[model samples]
Target: MKKFLATLTASSMLLLAACGQEGEKSGASTSGGGGGSGDKVIEVWHIETGEREKYFENVATQFEKANPGTDIKLLRIPNDAFKQKLSVAMSGGNPPDVFQSWGGGWLKNFVEQGSVTDITEQVDAAQFHKNAIANTTFDDKVYGVPLGISTNLVFYNKEIFAKYNLEEPKTWDEFVNVIETLKKNDIIPLSLANKTKWPGAYYLMDITSRLAGPELFESAFKRTGRGFDDPAYVEAGKYIQDLVKMDAFNPGFNGLPYDEGGSRQLLYTGQAAMINTTNSFINNIRAEAPEFEEKLGFFPFPSLPGGKGEMTHVPANTGPVFSVSTKAEEPKLAAEFLNLMTTKENAQIYTDTTGSLTAVNDAAPNDETMKPIYDYLATATHMQMPYDQTLPPELAEVHKDTTQALFGLSMTPEEAAKQMEAKAKEMLDK
Candidate 1:
């Protein structure tokens, strides 16, 4: 069933690519040095800006120094422009030597369209975490190498929690009590930026996994049973509405942007008590509110009573992955560059500079506050991908849009579930 779903997703990608996209080619540029005499230039497209951009540039410089002849032409694109630009580039038959990817459905599309090169025999698959490897694998072959990994959790201000005498909740009921207490004390309980829609979908993903367990996700993706209209999905919607009624989220959350210092600002400045987000959010804190360092704390999303889900189960993925493009002028060199980027030395640099966990076995971030969260993910029994990214593109959008409307009080839990189920059926039936 999983194989069938994968094939279906790949076919859909082929259809989209063949249809062609309409947009002016993006105005992105390559800034790395040209190759040595007689050496090949490996063009790379990545979606890292600020500190991470410099980190990758340094990695490329080291790779060129070691390889002597191969030069990396690195092009950094902003996240909003990345997908469309990459798609157009591939459809136009000029894919980069290496590009950033999220694997799962996103990579599968490129693999089907022959935009990504298969590197199963060229790289060591065992060096990365098992979950990380799985995300980049299709048809028993590796198409990309993981750069780093991420896991989601609730980041809170310790000073605020202690000020209210609130303990980190261990179960759903206790979590609700925490929210109610924070509200009574006139504090926003959760920092959410739903203007982008993806933020709200994370909450639904967390609760749906807890209420229904991971098998429900697999079933939905594979079209085996019940699908998105499952009782658990409806229950997840109800949970979000309950939080909404308690005034759990920050003001104008539905209009706030995640990247522009919306929720992170709320937590850093103590306008809000907690944020349920990915581990990389620490980087935001470091950049925006370095003074809040000692006051921050991390905790996994709490479990519900009688829930079959493990508290140790986390929504995690290898941070953006790097894949060699099949159309690259220097595919081997591109793959080699990818290999160099994952070396222990480079991986550690990634951790030190980004404050994000690495998929490399020993490359946990060096920050003291981030160490415990990295250690926790190291032993997690299950690492689930964000549901929206896991589903086919159409259905993923349905999940995102429906969840946002659910939060806006425009749809009942049942209505949202039915909408999601309808989209799932439309895609799966074909």
Candidate 2:
């Protein structure tokens, strides 16, 4: 999941409380046939705050203005609390009419539980990129509309790299050399905030893919010929531990919070030379310190010698997708609202404001800073969703926890691999 809010303000807390009360009142009528009412209320839940929240609110307002007698109730939830709240609502048989989704195993679970609406007939899948559409589709059925696309890569300080006479590394060995050089110079080679656990999982995910390829990971995830205990996974874990042992990351990174400016702050101060984070980091820097924009540089995760994965393989996926509830009182109306949210105009607004790429094929970032990302994504052969979002909820939590354990040196790479394999068997075997 993406952390949009660094810290929940008092007003946000109040909004959550109010939304909770509204959700209780609206849960009973979440789903049914459309057009049988005098006034319609579509309760929409999302984890967008700040300017993005304003954009959603503006869209809702526009929707209401265009469609009289229809009220769009917007619930802005904190990112950390969103999953728990949504899960509670879903399990209680009162999911919101439309809610934010990451649209992979996360959305797949909801579809399996019969909590998500099948929007195959309602949404025009061709309007979005195929990779973005893939995340929202299950069994050839469309269930959600993608809002944007996101990919993770290394963001380095160009000034620092120049000072050390280092260029972007294309191979794993060269990448390691760069990190070692940065560490030797008394700089944090990598800025990481693993207090939330998901940040560190990226390393394992990317390294495993680079070493053994996405096919192996997918096969292991599907419990086919491969398993999580494969050498690729263990090696990935070992790679992370090796970095930890070498003091590659900042001190106390395990306890730091990414949303609270933990890693980005280091980058801003030139104390950390690099951070492997999603493209949203560009928007974050633009928002926090526009002056540092020129100092920023990006590169994809380095390839491994003899590895099955190619350089074009990337850890990427659609940003938050929107799915309607299976039980929505006005499914068609909700679908129409989703359409309104994803219109070309709105998508352009989203791209312009967020400094990110919208899922809409026609909407792209105009900023030069995002051009490299756009270009890289254009040629990406394999876009991998984050492991936490790709795995079932229980398994996802275990992956994150064990990955964190690796960062903390509390578990050996082999032990972590075995632990993941055991969980996979326990979850998938059933």
CA lDDT scores, all candidates in order: 0.83, 0.87
The TM-score of predicted model 1 comes to 0.90
Candidate 2: RMSD over Cα atoms? 8.5
lDDT score for residue 366 of model 2: 83
Candidate 1 at residue 419, lDDT?
91
lDDT of 2 by residue, 215-328 (tens): 988898888889999988998998899889989999999999877888999999999999998888887887788889899999999998788998888899676799999879
lDDT of model 1 at position 324: 89
- Model 2 lowest lDDT segment of ten: 28-37
lDDT of 1 by residue, 2-44 (tens): 9999999999998886665322323665567434433677878
Candidate 2: residue 209 lDDT (0-100): 88
Candidate 1 local Cα displacement, residue 265, angstroms: 1.5
